[model samples]
Target: MRVAVTMSAEHEDARYPYDFLRHNYIVYLQNLGFVPVLVPNGIQNPEDYLTSLGVEGLVLTGGGDVDPARYGQENTASNEISPMRDETEFRLMQCAVDRHFPVLAICRGMQFMNVFFGGSLIQDIPTQVNAALDHRTGTHSIHVLDSRIEQALGIRVWDVNTYHHQGVHTTTVAPGLDIFATTEDNIVEGILHPAYPIIGVQWHPERPSPSPEIDLQLIRSFLDKAFWK
Candidate 1:
């Protein structure tokens, strides 16, 4: 199975002079029987490119922050904005949503989906929501609601890693979307499109998981769904 994973453009530095994908995501997908194709940062037509390559699904990987303007907000934090990456992913997501392609969005990818569906996000979780959880650098527990994720994993609660400062606004979630999991402080963690085969998790699934079995199950479930079609 060929799955297109988004890539982050690293600015030229002393060591490396060109943009490239970190091996974490590529290795993650390979473990699940997927040929991971790292997509270019700025494509003129992402859908056309994917179609030509016969990409079966999209795995939106974790990376820099999404543009605040996407969610109708002004930038007030020190978040690194990647407009080109954001634009490319938005187009890729549009094609995925339109075609009902299986999707797994992680971290900033989740935020991108929320904005694409007319949902707002907390620009800075600590400063905006004042949560007890240290979302920026702490591992925390989240309760999984009765949704796709819970159904797939057959578990209710999970302790997942965290490394983002933004989270989905539950009340402002897009129509046909449901919050499947949330932190104790009520920060959105997992989002599912009930009408579409799409799932977005705020936690980084590409990272080393504390529960290997469950993490593998999550990846397998998505792959199974994609293959089912």
Candidate 2:
């Protein structure tokens, strides 16, 4: 299957900007039998570009934080906000929602999905939430609350690698989406749209995992959903 994946934009020498994707993302997708198509951040018409590529699915890769202004908030806690990437992904998401396209959003991509669906983020977990777990580093346990995710991975509780400060909470979850998994501190870890082939996780599945089998199974489940005529 062909999948459209978003790339992160970074400034080189403060003069030139370039796009990059983690090699793990490409290797993981290829191992799962997916033909990955890299999508640049500076595209003028991302929705049209997706259509042009004839991709069957979309993968929103992790990178810089989504600008808070997009969610009607000020630039309080966000870092390395990429306006071009945000604009492109939002357009791609609009096309995905309209077409009921399959999407796998990871880390920052997951937070972006929440904002795209009329949801809010905590911005900075440490300062905003009391007694929050150390989300910037190390691995944490997340309790699977939905049967779909549980059945897909064959485990209820799993320790996932964490590297994000922003998070989604139960109260801030979107209307059409359901919280599928969360950490012990009540931080939202997974979300899925019941009506669409869209799933967002606060952890990076492409990165090295303690349980590699579970990660593979998750990607397999997404690929199965992405299969269409």
C-alpha TM-score for every candidate: 0.90, 0.94
* Candidate lDDT (C-alpha), each: 0.78, 0.86
What would the per-residue lDDT of candidate 1 be over residues 117-218, giving only the tens digit for each residue? 888878777877755578988688889885567778888887888999877866667777888888887788888777777888888777876666876787
Q: Candidate 2's residue-wise lDDT over 206-225, tens digit each? A: 88887678767876786576
Q: For model 1, what is the alpha-carbon lDDT of residue 143? A: 90
The 10 consecutive residues of candidate 2 with the worst lDDT sum are 220-229
Error of 2 at 81 (Å): 0.1
| Pairs of residues clashing in candidate 2 | none
Clash pairs (backbone) in predicted model 1: none
In candidate 2, stretches whose alpha carbon ends up further than 4 angstroms from where it belongs are 11-13, 226-229
What TM-score does candidate 2 reach? 0.94
